[model samples]
Target chain A: MELDFSIEGGDFTQAGQASSRVKKVLKQLGVDAKCIKSIVIALYEAEVNVVAHAYKGQIHIQIDKDKIQTLITDEGPGIPDIAMAMTEGFSTASKKVREMGFGAGMGLPNIKKNTDELKIDSVVGQSTTVSMVNYF
Target chain B: MKVSEIIDQLGLKVIAGEKGLDREISGAYVSDLLSDVMGNAREGQIWITLQVHQNVMAIASLKDLAAVILVKDLEANANTIQHSNEEQIPILSSSLSTFDIAGKLHALLADK
Candidate 1:
């Protein structure tokens, strides 16, 4: 099965809707509880990152018999240093974003911790794409 | 224990999602950081925090949390209350500070 969702940046109200829908689908597919939890967590973090940082984004999901894959691409002020951005306590989110209890710099690390395979690509001034996969 | 019982015992005001008062409470996770709660909180746990944004409800629903307790008498945003009602995950409130409420809740759960 395949799914796609559009993410509007700065729209925190709608941030996790895509993840929630995907979670329901995974549950109905009889995915294991633990597996679903990890997938949802990673997907949600990525979704929120787009809402928090990007101008806009898109999510693509593919689910097969043995695995699930997610690709989130965003147009924004892309990461200048992917390595530094991946660190647990590093973030460039604005003060308003931080005040809402996000911007703690745990977003990427949480995604990494929950997904089996993770890849991140970014161009400093243009865009970023995050791809992650988990085996069932 | 059930969410309703905690509300009664803790004297937490039910802000919204009264339909979910009967939900089971496995435990509690206390934090104001959205990502921290998302990363570490387990399903069926009640979340204690001061965050009043609508995204708090989003995280609560995605995590399948039992309920959300807003400490220090903080009021959730209008949209947050609306989301809580729609999701049926109760939004509870306490005038006590996060530290105090967390301590009380921890002691109560430990007694169970």
Candidate 2:
């Protein structure tokens, strides 16, 4: 099965709607409870990244018998250093995003911890694409 | 322990999602950072934090948390309350600071 969701940038109020829907779908499909938790956390952090930093983004989720894959693509001021961005405690979030209890620089690190296979690509001043996969 | 029991014992005020007062609490995770909770908190855990925002509800729901206890008497926003109601994850308030509430909550859950 496949699902796609559009995420609006700077919309903190609606940040996790996509992740919530995907979680329900995973539950209905009888995915393991532990796996569902991992996927939900990873996807949610990705969603928040888009909402907190991107102009806009798209999430594409695909579920197969063997694994679940998520691709998040965002148009924004792309990360100048994917290496630095992947480091925990490194974030460029604005004062407002930080005030909301986010931007602690743990987002990407959390994603990496949850997903089994991860890849991140970015171009300065253009866009970023993150793809993650978790085996069943 | 049930969420309501914690509220009663700790003198917490139910701010929203009254429907979930009976939800069972397995543990407590205290943090003010959204990513910390998102990355580490587990199902059935009661989150103790000072954050009072709509995104907090989103994390609580996605994490399948039993409840959210806001420390220092901080009040959740309208959107936070609305989401709490919709998700049936109770938002609770306490007059104590995070340090006090965390210690109390830890002792309570530990005794269980």
Candidate 3:
């Protein structure tokens, strides 16, 4: 099965909607509890990155018999330094965003730690795409 | 311990998600940073923090936390309450600071 979701930038009000929906689907499909948690965390952090930095984004999810894959593509201020952004404590979030307790620079790392595979593609001044997979 | 028991013992105010008062708790994690909680907090743990936002509920739901205790009399936003209700994860409020709440919760869970 496949699912699609759209995320809006700077919209903290609905930040977790996509992740929440995906979680429900996973639960109904009888995915393992532990695997569901990891998938949810990774998907959520990816969703938040779009809401926090992108202009807008689309999330594509594919659920197979053995694994789940997600690709989050966002049109935004593309990350200039993917390596730096992956660092645990480096962030480019605005002051207002930081005050909300996000932008702690832990999003990507958390995603990487939870997911079995992670790939990030970005071009400065254009967009960023994050792909992640978690095996059931 | 159960969430309701914690409320009675700690004098916590149920701000929202009262339906989850019976949820079982196994541990406690204290952090104001959302990602830190996402990365480290375990299932069935009560999160004690000063963060009073909607994303707190998001993390609690995604991580399957027992409940959330907002310290120092902090209150959650409207959206946060809505999500809490939807997710059925209690959002408790405490007049005590984070340190005080964490200590009490730690001692309680330790005894368990």
Candidate 4:
């Protein structure tokens, strides 16, 4: 199965919609509870990242018998230092974003911990793409 | 224990999603950070925080949380209450601070 979703920057109200839908689909497919939890967590963090930082983004998901794959691409101020951004407690979010209890710099780390494979590509002034996969 | 039991014991005011008052509560997590709650909170746990935005409801629904407790008498945004009602996950209120409410909730759950 395949799925796609669009994410709008600064739209905090709609941030987790994709994650919630994917979760329901995974549940109906009889995915293991642990696997579903990890997938949902990673996808949600990535979705929120787009809403928080990017100008706009798209998410593509592919589910096969053995694994689930996700690609999140965003157009915005891409990460200048992916390594630094992955570190805990590092963030560049504005004051307003921080006041809403986000931008704590745990987003990427959480995605990494929950996914079996993860890749991040960015063009500092243009766009970023995050690809992640988890085996069933 | 059920959500209604905690509401009765803690004197939490039900702000919305009264339909979920019978939902089961496995535990409680106290945090104002959205990502922290998302990364560490487990399913069936009641979230206690001061965040009043609709994003809080988004996280609560995605996490399959039992309910949300807004501490310090903070009122949720209009859209937040709307989402709570839509998802059927109760939005509860308490005048107590996060620290006080968390402590009380901890004691209450420990006895269960």
Best by lDDT: 1
lDDT of 4 by residue, B34-111 (tens): 999999998999999999999999999988899999998999999999999999999999999999999999999998
Say what the interface RMSD of candidate 2 is: 0.5
What TM-score, computed on C-alpha atoms, does each candidate reach?
Answer: 0.98, 0.98, 0.97, 0.98
Residue-by-residue lDDT tens digits, candidate 4, A1-136: 9999999999987789899999999999999999999999899999989999999999999999999999999999999999999999899998999999999988899999999999999999899999999998
lDDT of 2 by residue, A32-130 (tens): 989999999999999999999999999999999889999999999999989999999999999999999899999999999999999999998999999
- For model 2, state the Cα shift of residue A115 in Å: 0.8
Each prediction's DockQ? 0.95, 0.94, 0.80, 0.91
**CA lDDT of every candidate:** 0.95, 0.94, 0.91, 0.94
Candidate 4: RMSD over Cα atoms? 0.8
Tens-place lDDT per residue, model 3, A48-120, is 8998999999999999999999999999999999999999989998888899889999999999899999999
- Give me the overall lDDT of model 2: 0.94
Q: Give the per-residue lDDT of model 2 (tens digit) for B17-55.
A: 999989999898988899999999988999998898899
Q: Regarding lDDT, does 1 or 4 come out ahead?
A: 1
Question: In model 3, how large is the Cα lDDT of residue A103?
Answer: 93
Could you tell me the fnat of model 3?
0.76
lDDT value, residue B79 of candidate 2: 93
Pick out the ten consecutive residues of candidate 2 chain A with the lowest summed lDDT.
Answer: A11-20
Pick the winner on lDDT between candidates 3 and 4.
Answer: 4
Candidate 3: tens digits of C-alpha lDDT, residues B2-103: 999988889899999999999999889989889899888999999998888899998899889999999988879998999999999999999998888888
Q: Which stretches of candidate 3 lie over 4 Å from their true place?
A: none
